[model samples]
Structures are given as structure tokens and as C-alpha cells.
Target chain A: DVKVTQSSRYLVKRTGEKVFLECVQDMDHENMFWYRQDPGLGLRLIYFSYDVKMKEKGDIPEGYSVSREKKERFSLILESASTNQTSMYLCASSHPSDRTYEQYFGPGTRLTVT
Target chain B: EDQVTQSPEALRLQEGESSSLNCSYTVSGLRGLFWYRQDPGKGPEFLFTLYSAGEEKEKERLKATLTKKESFLHITAPKPEDSATYLCAPHEDTGRRALTFGSGTRLQVQP
Candidate 1:
């Protein structure tokens, strides 16, 4: 079984504060992604990394950034938190090949930006 | 633009009620289609992946079938534990690793 773990299940941050969400996967997958879930928006990708030290912006990447310095770890960074940024953040990892387009997800981090 | 649309935004069913959720998609070329189940306050758990038309996959009481333009997830004699939000995602031919997701259909099964 694949396991993806996030640093925190819940987080609270004040406006303008910097926040970081960490994710680690045990499957040695080369693709990792960050997404935010809202009531009506479903899950929109914020950022994704195909390899260590490589990244790509997704549909809603304006307010978020990601780092993939190591193969098993990926980090999402919010330079300055805002109330509008509060949402359920999810981390997923997957193997790009072998028809493994199915991504394994973590429990998710509910971030509250106040 | 590539898109995925799921219908019957919400459904309420008795324990034994049987129904199906629809996922319609429009993409340049379909690479794959995925289904996921999500509970409140948690991330989505993968359910099925349909790679081509006329394909079908089943698990427990849930069966997924796919066509060129859409997919259907049929639930049979569902239980209370089957209540969750079902999401539909489609991978386009853009060659990117990202998937376009539908808003999802929330299912509620009462005992």
C-alpha cells in the first residue's frame, strides 16, 4: 500500500504570516501534487512536481509555491497567509508511468487563515 | 478547454436503494478517467480508473463504466458506510500530470 503523510491535519495562521505544509510519500513516486478543496470548486491543483527540484504551476498557483528538494518530500509554501486562502489542502503522490495516473492522497491539512 | 461535469449534485438513498452517478467530460483526447470517494474533512481516496470506452471496473457494490463521452458509477444495495462525496476526474491529452476534476456528487445513505 502507498502512504502519503502530511505534517499537520489542522493549522491556524494570522494574516501575512508565512506558512508551510509538508508532505512525505513512502512509494518513491516521481509525481507529487498540492491541491486546495473548496465547497463548490472541488479540488484544484495548486502546484505539482515531476522530479526533485522541478516544479510546475497549476490552475490556481498565484498564491502558492512548492518545493521538491528531495524525492520523498514535497512542501507547499504560502508567503503570506490570508483569510481567502483558508481551505482543505491535500497532498498526493503517484507514479507517472505504468498507467498509475491514480494518485494516492494524504489525510489533508485544514488550514485556517485568520 | 477540457472539462469534467458530474450530475445530481447530491443524492439521498435508503440502505438498500440503488442508483448511479454520472460524469460527463469533454476533452481533446482522453488519456484516462478517475473516480474518488471523499469523506468530510479528509482527502479523496481513489476508487477506479477507466482508460477507454467499453471498459468496466467493479469493487464491492460499486461498478464503474466508461464511454467516449462519459462515465457512470453504479451503486447497488448501498449501506450507510457508502455515504461520501464522489468525484470525477479526467486526464486530457495535454501530456501533463494534472487532472481536471468535477465538482463532485455527495451521496448519503441512511440506515
Candidate 2:
């Protein structure tokens, strides 16, 4: 079984503060992704890393960035947190070589910016 | 542009009732269609993966079928524990590993 764990289940941050959300996977997947889910809208990709230190911007990458210094860990950072940035952040990992392309997800972090 | 759409935003069913959820997609080239079930405040759990048209996969009371342009998740004799949001994502063979997900169908089963 693939296990993906997030650092925090819930977080509250003040405006203009920096926020970091961490995710770790035990499956050693080659692909890691960050997404923010909102009501009425589905999961929108924020950033993804295919390999260590290699990152690509997803559909909504603005105000968000990611880091993949280690194979098992992926981190999402917010330069300046805003109320609009408050949403359910999800982390997922997949092994591209599997060909099935099914991503295993973490429990998710609900960030609230005040 | 790739698009994935799910119909009947929400559904309510009585215990022992059966129904199906729909997921329609349009992409450059079909690679795989994935189905996931998400409970409240939790991440999605992978259910089944459909690779091509006419492919079907089943687990317990849940079965998934794929066509050229759509996929259906048929729930048979659902129970209260079967309630959850069903999400479908289509992977396009555009050399990118990202998947475009649909808004999801929220299902509620009442005992």
C-alpha cells in the first residue's frame, strides 16, 4: 500500500505570513503534485515535480511554489498568504513507469488565511 | 484544451438502491481514465483505472466501465457507507503527467 502523509491536517495563518505545507510519500514515486481544491471548482494543479529539484508550473501556480529536495518529501510554500489562498491543499505522488498513471493522495491540509 | 465533466452534481439514494455516476471527457489523446473516491476532509482513494474502450473493472459492489468518450461507475445495492464524492480524471497523452479532474459527483446513501 502507498502511504502519503501531510504535515498538518489544519492550519491558520495571518495575512502576509509565509506558509509551508509538507508531504511525504513512502512509495518513492517519481512524480509529485500540489493542488488546491475549492467548492464549485475541482482540483486545480499548482505545481508538480518530476524529479529532484525539477519543478513545473501547473494551471494555477501563481502565489505558490514547490520544493522537492528529497525523493520522499515535497513541500509547498506560499510567499505571502492571502485570504484568497485559503483552500484545501492536496499532495499526490505517482510512479510514471507504472503506466497506469494512478496517483496516490495524502489526507490533505485545510489552510485558512485570516 | 482538455475537458472533463461529471453530471448530476449530487445524488441521494436509499440503502440497497443502485445507481450510476457519469464522467465525460475530451482530450487530445486518451491515455488512461482514473476513478477515485473521496470522503469528507480526506484525500481521494484510487478506485479503478480504465485504459481503453470496452474495458471494465470491478471491486465489491462498485464497477467501472469505459467507452470512447465517457466512463460510468455503477454502484450496486449501495449501503450508507458507500456515500462519498466520486471523482474522475482523464490523462491525456501530451507528455505531461498531470490529470484534468472533474468537479465530482457527491453521493449520499440514507439508511
Candidate 3:
């Protein structure tokens, strides 16, 4: 079974503070993604990494940045946390050749920016 | 633009009731459709993946079927544990690995 683990289950940060959310996967998948889930907006992609040091912006990447220094780890960074940034953040990983393109997800981190 | 839409924002069902959830997409050159179940305050759990029209997959009491433009998740004799939000995402062959997800259908099963 594949396992994806996040650094935190819940976090609280003050406005303008820097925040980091870490994710690690044991499946050695080549693709990793960061998404934020809101009530009506669904799961909107924030950023994704296809390989080490390779990153791509998704639909809503303006306030977020990601790092993929290693294959097993992906980190999401918030330059300046704001109340609007509070949401459930999810991390997922998938292998390119998995035909199904099924992404295994972590438990998610609920960040609260106050 | 690619889009995925789910119908019946919420559904309430009695235990042992049978129903289906719908997911429609407008992505061109469809690659795959994925179904996931999510409980409150947690990430989604993958359920099934449909690759092409006429394809079907099942697990226990849940069955997923795909057509050219939409997919259906049919639940049979659901139990209270079956209550969760069902999400669908459609992947397009646009050389991007990201999937556009639907808002999701929230299901509640009362015992």
C-alpha cells in the first residue's frame, strides 16, 4: 500500500507570517501535487512537481510556492499567510506510468491564518 | 476550458437505499475519470478510475460507470458508513498532469 504523510494535521499562523507544509510519500512516485480545498471552489491545484527541482503552477498558484528538492518530499510555502489563505491543504503523489493516473493523498493539513 | 460538474449537491438516503451520483465533464480528449470519497476534515480516498466509455468498475456495493460525457457512481443498499462526499475529476490529454475536479456530491445515509 502507498503511504503519504503530511507534517501537520492542523496549524495556526498570524497574518504575514511564513508557513510551510511538508509532505512525504513512500511510493517513489514521480509526480506530486499541492491543492487547497474550499467549500464551493472544490480542490484547486496550487502547484505540482513532476521531478526534482521541476515545478509548475496550477490554476491558483499566485499565493503559494512549492519545493521538490527530493523525490520523496514536497513542500508548500506561503510567502505571507493571510486569512484568505486558510483552507485544508492536501498533498498527492502519482506515478506517470500508472495508466489510471490515480493519486494517493495524504490526510491533509488544515491551516488557519489569523 | 476544461470543467467538471457534479449534480445534486447533497443527497439524504435511508439505510439500504439505492441511488446514483452523477459527474459530468467538458474536457476534450478525455484521458481518465477518477472517483473519490472524502469525509469531513480529511483528504479524499480514491475509489475507482474509468478510462473510456463503456468501462465499469466495482467495489463491494459501489459501482462506477463511464460514458462519453459523464460518469455515474451507483450505490446499492447503502449503509450509514457509506455517507461521504463523492468527488469526480476528469483528466484531459493536454499534456498536463493536473485534473479538474467537480464540487462533489455530499451523501448522507441514515440508519
Candidate 4:
């Protein structure tokens, strides 16, 4: 079975502190994505990587960065955590082909910036 | 810009009741439409993938159908376990691998 695992299910950080959320996929998918899910905003993409060391900014990329140093791992970095950044962060992985357009997601990390 | 919209933000049904969730999208060209089920506090799980109009796919109590402008996720004889937030996402031909998602339809099935 395809599996996506996140580094944490819940995280709390202080204002102005750096935060990191990690995601790993066992399916060896070529594409990885980071998204922030709000109550009414749905899932807004923050960043995505189609290959190692390659990243693209999504619609809401401000205040966030991503790292894809390895094929199976992707990370989302918050430069300075603020109250506005408190939201559910999700990580997903999928193949780059149209045949595998369905992305598999991790359980998610609920981050709280206090 | 590609956009996805889901209707009836929330739905309530009793056991064995049937209902349908709607997802409408506007894109340059449709590549695929996806359905996902998300439980509270968890991530979305893949349900169906529709590639073209008139395409249909089924899994147990759930059926998904697509048309030129929208897609429907029909739930039949839903049980309490069927309660979840149904999400729809569309992939366009813009060479981007990311999907544009709708806000989602929250379904509640009570016994």
C-alpha cells in the first residue's frame, strides 16, 4: 500500500520561531506538495516539487519555503511563525503522470503559532 | 485560471439515505477530476478519478460521475461511517502537476 507519513500530528511554536514540517512517502512518487488547509479556504498549495532540488511556488508561498533534498522526503519551512500561520499543514505525493494524478496524503500536521 | 467549486457546503442524512455532492470547475482543458474523503482531523483519502465526460466509477456505496462542466459524487444507502468531508479537485492542461481544490462538502450520516 502507498503510504505518506508526517513528522508530527501536532506542533506548537512561539512567534518569530522557525518551524519545520517533514513528510515522507514510501511510494517513491516523483511529485510532492505542501498545502495549508483552513476552515473555509480548502487546501491552498504552498509549494511543490517535481524532482529533487527543484521547487515551485504555489498560490500562497509567502512566509514559507520547501526543501526536497531526497527522493522520498519533503519539508516545509516557516521562516517566522505567527498567529496567522496556525493551520493544518498537509503533505501529499503523487506520480508526475496523468495516469497517477490522484495524490496520496499524510495524516497532516496541525500547527499552532502562539 | 483554473478553479473548482463544491456546492451544499454541508449535508445531513440518516442511515440508508441517499444524496449527491456536486463539484463544478472551470479550466482551460480538463485532464482529470478527483474525489477524496477526509475524516475529521485527518488527511484526504483518494476515492475516484474521472478522466472525461460521461465517465463513471464506483466503490461500494459511492459512485462518481463526470460531465462537461461538473461532477457528482452519489452516495447510496449511506451509513454513519460514510460521514466525511468530500473534496473535489481538478487538474488542468496548464502543465502544472498541482490540483486546484474546492472547499469541500461536509457530509454527516447519522444512525
Candidate 5:
């Protein structure tokens, strides 16, 4: 089974605090992604990395940054956490040649910014 | 830009009832289409992956079929435990691995 592990399942922080959400995948997939899901808006992409240390901004990257220092790990950082950033954060990974476009996801981290 | 839309923003059905969820899309070149089932507060779980027009795939009571411009996930005799949010996405024309997702359909199967 493809396993994608997130560092935390839930977190709460104060406004303007810097936060980090970490994820690790064991499948060695080349593509890793971070998305935040909210009511009405659904799942909006924040960022994605195709390889180690390479990242691209998705539709909603503002106030968010990502780091991929190792092939198996990807981290999503909130420069300054705000109440608006409270939502379910999901991490996904997929192989480069996966024509099926199938992405395996972690359980997700629910963040609550006060 | 690739566009994917799912119909019936929400649905409710009795256990053992059968129904279908529709996904309409517009893209530059068809690469692949995906169906995912997401439970509340959890990440979406992969259900089926369909690649070309006229292709279909199935698992248990769920069957996914694709056409030139749309895809359908048919659920048969569903159970209360089968309730979930169904998501559809299109593999973009960009060689890069990025997917554009729909808002999703929230399904409730009551016993």
C-alpha cells in the first residue's frame, strides 16, 4: 500500500504565528502536492513539488510556502497564520509516469488558527 | 484552462437505492479523468481512474465511465456507509503534474 504520513492530525495556533505542516510519503513518488479544503470552495491547490527543492505555486499560494528537502518529505509553511488559514490540509503524492493521474493522499491535518 | 464541474452539489438516497453522479469537463487534450470518494474530515480515497473516451472501470457498487467530454460515476444499491463526497478532476495539458478539481458532490445514503 502507498503510505502518505502527515506530521499532525490537528493543530491550533494564534494569529500571526508561523506554522509548519509536514508530510512524508514512502512510495518515492516524484510529485507531491498541498491543498486546503474549505466549505463551498472545495479543494484548492496551494503548492506542488515535482522534485526535491523544486516547487510551484498553485491557485492559492498566498501566505503559504512549501519545502521539499528530501524525496520522501514535503512541508507546508504558513509565514503568518491567520484565522482565514483554518482548514483541512491534505498532502498527496504520485509517480511521474502515473498516466492514471492517480494521487495517493494522507489522512489530512485540520488546522485551526485563532 | 481545464474546467471540471460536478452535478447535484448534494444528493440523498435511501439504502439500497441506485443513482449516478455526473462530472462534466472541458480540457485542451484528454489525458485522464479520476474519481475519488472522500469521507468527512479525511483526504479523498482513490476509487477509479479512466483514461479515454468510451472507457469504463468498476469496483463493487461503483462504476465509472468516460465519454469525450464527460464522466459518470454510477452507484448501485448504496448503503449508509457508502455516503461521501465525490470529486472529479482533469489532468491538465501542462506537462507538469497538477490537477484541477471540482467542488465535489456530497452524498448522503440513509438507512
Candidate 6:
């Protein structure tokens, strides 16, 4: 079975701290995505990588960055954490082929900034 | 913008209740439509994928049907464990990677 795992399920950080949320996928998929889910606003994409070292900004990429140093691993970095950045962060992976449009998501990391 | 919308922001059902959830889209060309069920704290779980009009797929008590402009997920005799937020997304024809998602409908099944 395909599995996606995140580094943490819940995280609390202080303002101005640099936070990192890591994710890994067992399937050698070519696409990885980071999204922040909030009430009323739904899921807003932050960044996505189609391959190692290739990243694209999504609808809400401000104050967030991603790293794809390896095929199985992808990381989301908040350069400066703030209270507004507190939200549930989700990581997802999918195969490159168009057939696998369905993305496999991790359990998610609920971050709280204070 | 590849827009997608889901109706009935919330739905409450009793055990064995039958209902349907709707998802409408206004993209230029429909590449694919996806359905996911998300729990309170966990990520959304993949449920169904409808490719084109007249396409349909079923698993357990849920049946998904598609048309030119919309799709429907029909639940037949739901259970308490089935409560979750249902999400719908439409894949773009060109990129095929990015998906435009709807606001989702929260379903609470009462036992």
C-alpha cells in the first residue's frame, strides 16, 4: 500500500521561529505538494514539487518554502513563524502519470504559532 | 480559474439514511474529478475518481456518478463511522497535476 508520513502530528512554536514540517512517501511519485487547510477557506496550496529540486509556488506560498532534496522526502519551511501562519499543514504525493491524479496525503501537522 | 463548488455546506444523517452530495464545476475541459473523505484531524482519504460524463464507480455504500457539468456521490444507508468532510476537486486538462478543490461538505452521521 502507498503511504505518506509527516514528521509531526502537532507542533507549537513561538513567533519569529523557523519551523520545519517534513513529509515522505514510499511510492516513488514525481509530484509532492504542501497545503494549509483552514476553516471557510478550505485547502490552499502553498508549494509543490514535480521532481527533486524543482518547486513551484501555489496560491498561498507567501512566508512558506519547500525543499525536495530527495525523491522520497519533501520539506516545508516557514522562514519566520507568526500567529497568522498557525494552521493545519498537509503533505501529499502523487505519481507523475496523469492516471494517478489522486494524491495520497499524510496525517498532517497541526502547527500553532504563538 | 478552474472553479469547483459543492452544495449543502453541512448534512446530518441518521443511521441507514440515504442522501446525495453534489459537486459542480465550470472548467474549460474536464480532465478528471476526485472525491475525498477527511476526518477531523487526519488528512483526506481518497474515495472515488470520475473521468468523464456518464462514468460511475462504487464502493461499499457510496456510489459516484458524473455528468458534463457536475458529479454526485450518493450514500445508501450510511453509518456513524461515515461521518466526515467530503471534498471534491477538478483536475486541469493541461497541467493534470494541480487540482482545484471545492469548499467541501461536512457530513455528520448519527447513530
The whole-model lDDT of each prediction reads 0.92, 0.92, 0.92, 0.92, 0.90, 0.91
lDDT of 3 by residue, A41-96 (tens): 99989998889999999889988889999999999999999999999999998886
DockQ of each: 0.75, 0.78, 0.75, 0.75, 0.67, 0.69
Model 3 alpha-carbon drift over 4 Å, by segment: A98-100
Residue B85 in candidate 5, Cα distance off native in Å:
0.8
For B1-111, candidate 2 gives per-residue lDDT tens digits of 449999789999999999999999988688889999999999998999999999999999999999999999999999999999999999888976567899999999999
Per-residue lDDT value at B50 in model 6: 92
Q: Number of clashes in every candidate structure?
A: 0, 0, 0, 0, 0, 0
Better of 3 and 5 by DockQ: 3
Better of 3 and 6 by DockQ: 3
Candidate 6 regions with alpha-carbon error over 4 angstroms = B94-97
In lDDT terms, how accurate is model 2? 0.92
- Model 5 steric clash pairs: none
- For candidate 1, what's the TM-score of chain A, rounded to 2 decimals? 0.96
The true-versus-predicted C-alpha distance at residue A56 of model 2, in Å, is: 1.6
Which residue pairs collide in model 1, if any?
none
- Give the higher-lDDT candidate: 4 or 6: 4
Question: On a 0 to 100 scale, what is the lDDT of residue A72 in model 6?
Answer: 93
Which stretches of model 4 miss by more than 4 angstroms? none
Q: What tens digits encode model 5's per-residue C-alpha lDDT throughout B1-111?
A: 438889989999999999999999987687888889999878999888888889999999999999999999999999998999999987766764567788898999999
Each candidate's B-chain TM-score, in sequence, is 0.96, 0.97, 0.97, 0.96, 0.95, 0.95
Q: What is the lDDT of residue B77 in candidate 4?
A: 97
Show the lowest summed lDDT stretch of 10 residues, model 5 chain A.
Answer: A94-103
By TM-score, how accurate is candidate 4? 0.95
- How far residue B51's Cα lies from its native spot in candidate 6, in Å, is 1.3
Tens-digit lDDT string for candidate 6 (B15-58): 99999999999986888899999998999888999988999999
